[model samples]
Target: MPATSALRKAKLTVTISGDVINEIDEIAKEKGNPRSQVMEEILRDWLLKSKKMAIEKDIEAYYISLTENEKKENREWSMIATESAKRTWND
Candidate 1:
């Protein structure tokens, strides 16, 4: 499906806990928005944070998977680049 089509609003009938519904209602009242809008905003924020954490975990895994030799090489390359920069700036 097209991304836009997937993003299009659709109504869902869900059974939410009473306590959760009350919290949503409170947020709606505080923000002067409908319960659905408050829920959507909360869900969007949660999804974004989840995606960021997943990406961070993936990056950490990638670094952890590198061999010791590869890590040493990467450190050496970084040191060389730093030295080159320092020389350029001093001259």
Candidate 2:
């Protein structure tokens, strides 16, 4: 996907639960923003978190598929990196 600096606005028609609407309204009021802004912020956060979780799952699956020798090497490298970081921090 191409990155854009501008946000595109669109009109959406959907039915939402009353409880959810109330909560969204409350958040909008608290933040002094319109309901649309509140909803957009929430959806953006959800999308980012969902993407991060998917990436994490993909990494975990890849790691699980690695051979034992490769996994051992990865762990050794991680430990060495951790030790180096600790030394750098202490210094």
Candidate 3:
């Protein structure tokens, strides 16, 4: 797919465990945000962190906390290749 075609956005519905749902509701109340707004903020944070935003300290700590399986063992290109293949093919 072209970049634009690859970037379609839509609403999604997911079923969460009761405990998780309750926690989300509690956080929404505490933050004074609707559930959808809270979800959007959380998703925005995840995207920013994934893309290695300006928060180097947080990103560094995040990298440091990775499990062995999560770290790259080879050069950057090889890691990118492996990750691309993994992302393109589930299981």
Candidate 4:
């Protein structure tokens, strides 16, 4: 987590499987961090990954809805961008 004084904390209570708890404890011990910190990092990563997947899905749907001409134009623009990147890197 970023060092922000504005961050708020809330207490949550939930039941988890013993096996999962054991794994989290082990990781926490190895990293010298509390179980809450480990869980927070895990949840944060999951949230980011979920957000990325949702964005990708939306982009896929957008592409699928595009007309043939729009797709061709996109392809052409992609090729131009690729060539520009290559030139920039090779220079």
TM-score of each: 0.75, 0.81, 0.44, 0.81
**Cand. 3 Cα-lDDT:** 0.82
Better structure of 1 and 2 per lDDT: 1
Candidate 4: give its CA RMSD in angstroms. 3.0
- TM-score for candidate 4: 0.81
lDDT agreement with native, every candidate: 0.96, 0.95, 0.82, 0.96
Record all residue pairs in model 1 with backbone atoms less than 3 Å apart, i.e. clashing. none
Query: Candidate 3 residues 1-91, lDDT tens each?
Result: 5798657766889887999779889999999999987887888889988667657878789889977766655356687998999999986
The number of clashing residue pairs in each candidate reads 0, 0, 0, 0
lDDT of 4 by residue, 8-90 (tens): 78789989999999999999999999999999999999999999999999999999999999999999999999999999999
Error of 4 at 10 (Å): 1.3
Candidate 2 colliding pairs: none
lDDT of 4: 0.96
10 residues in a row with least lDDT, candidate 4:
1-10
Worst 10 residues of 3 by lDDT: 68-77
Candidate 2 lDDT, 27-88, residue by residue in tens? 99999999999999999999999999999999999998999999999999999999999999
Provide the global lDDT of candidate 2 against the true structure.
Answer: 0.95
Q: After the best TM-score superposition of candidate 4, give how far the Cα of residue 77 lies from its true spot, in angstroms.
A: 1.5
lDDT for model 1: 0.96
